[model samples]
Target: MMADLREMYTFEFMRYALTVGVFGGGMLAFLGIFVHLRRIVFLGAALPQITALGIALAIALHLPLLVGAVLGGLVGILLLSTSGKPGHLPTEGWVGLAYASGGSLAIVVLALSPHPDAGALRFFTGDVLGTNRAEALFAIAVAGFTALIFRLCWSKFVVSSFDPVMSQTLGLKVRRWNALLFLCLGFGLAAVMNSAGSMLAFGMLIGPPAAALMCFRAFPKVVVTTVVLGAGAAFVGLTASFLFDLPGGPTMATAALAPVLPAWIYRKIRK
Candidate 1:
């Protein structure tokens, strides 16, 4: 059974896949807790596809795709800034328009760009089995950043998460903190993009924390369970991708959903 998925690492891309599965899983597992709790999972959710547009544009224009993605994320942040929610800069209506525009812009760019190929397909589809040493190092850096932030600002983030007004009243720069959190999520989204591609990246952003929150009894448990589920999903998904010769990123994402779906269905049934 295991031989069906014997990884052939003679090719470089396969290493990148597994590398991403491990390191990307680590970073995202940590980040998922915040996005899940804050209900802003969509930053991870929507931005990667938008980033793909930027990458496609860069391809056509002969620029670096990664730089294009960072630019795209910056554009997303700019759009969000104008989104009003109380102290938020943009109104709900404005945010909706922003999302619509972002998605539409990506489609237009893809349609206009030249030289679309499997290479480009990797962006939307994911290439988990293709992990390389450099990408793995990148993943480690992202994971390190996430861990550092979580350790240094866990309490502040938690207070703001559950009760923002009180957190602010205590002299925390509430608005600035929220913006910083979103920025972290954006950086995270960009970092994890290659590991899981678009939707898989979105799944990593949402799945583990969601599963942990549902299964665990306490906040601390949420953290532990989230990381565990994230790693488990990545391992299982990568294995599945190997067996089926499927795209690693989406397979990992679909596998990530495996735990969540049954739990969600069970919750609904019990209700």
Candidate 2:
């Protein structure tokens, strides 16, 4: 098994894919804690579709995929963040619209692109094994930056997130913190969606943190466990996919979600 593993990673592409899987999965899982805490899981789902739309637009316009993804994610954040205000449609309604339209539009735009790349389908279907060195490095950089920011502003972020009114009373700049958090979410989603596709991006964002939160109440332990599970799922899923000749992205997503049921059962038993 060890020799086979070594042989599999002897190719640079496999190493690059693994790097993206680990770092991208870990980062999305970490950010997912905030998504869960804020009860914005729908928003998380919508953003990936929006990011895909951006990728399709970039392909159509011959722009950078990262640039399009970032813009698309940010636009989704801006639109969805303000949707909680009193309106005819509930926030969920608007989020659902974005989710539906964004995905449909991406496919339409991609279909219309005059210069579509042969691998363009991979953007939606996922092609993690095709990841390049630059994409792997970008994943690492984004993950490191996210960790560093949260490390420096842990208390502020936590306080602002869970208790906005109290955060305002304490003059913690709640709005600024919230915006920063959304910015990080948008950036991270864009990066992950660009490389791993929307399925892996959304799966990693929701799965590990959901399981970790089910098992533990301590934020620090939850964070650690979530990252570990996410990265471990990526490794396990990629290896399984390789060995079984299955699809890599969906395999990783399934692995990421595998812990949820066990954790839920554990919680029920403890209670």
What TM-score would every model get versus the actual structure? Answer: 0.84, 0.97
lDDT of 2 by residue, 1-271 (tens): 9999999989898888889899989999999999999999999999999999998998889997888888999999999888867857899999999999999999999999997888776768877887888788888888898899999999999999999998899889998989989998998888778877999999999999999999999988999999999999999989998999988888888999999999999999999
Whole-model lDDT values for every prediction: 0.68, 0.91
Candidate 1 lDDT over 1-271, as tens digits, reads 5444454544566666666766677567667787777666555555666666666677667676566666776667666654566865545555566556666766677667775545655666676554456556777776777778878988887888789888878888877767766666666666667445777777777887777666666888888777777777877887777667787888888776677876677557766
How many Å off is the CA of 95 in candidate 1? Answer: 4.4
- Candidate 1 error regions (>4 Å): 1-11, 85-95, 114-118, 129-133, 265-271
Strongest candidate by TM-score: 2
Off by over 4 Å in 2: none
Give the C-alpha miss distance for residue 102 in model 1, angstroms.
2.8
Worst 10 residues of 2 by lDDT: 118-127
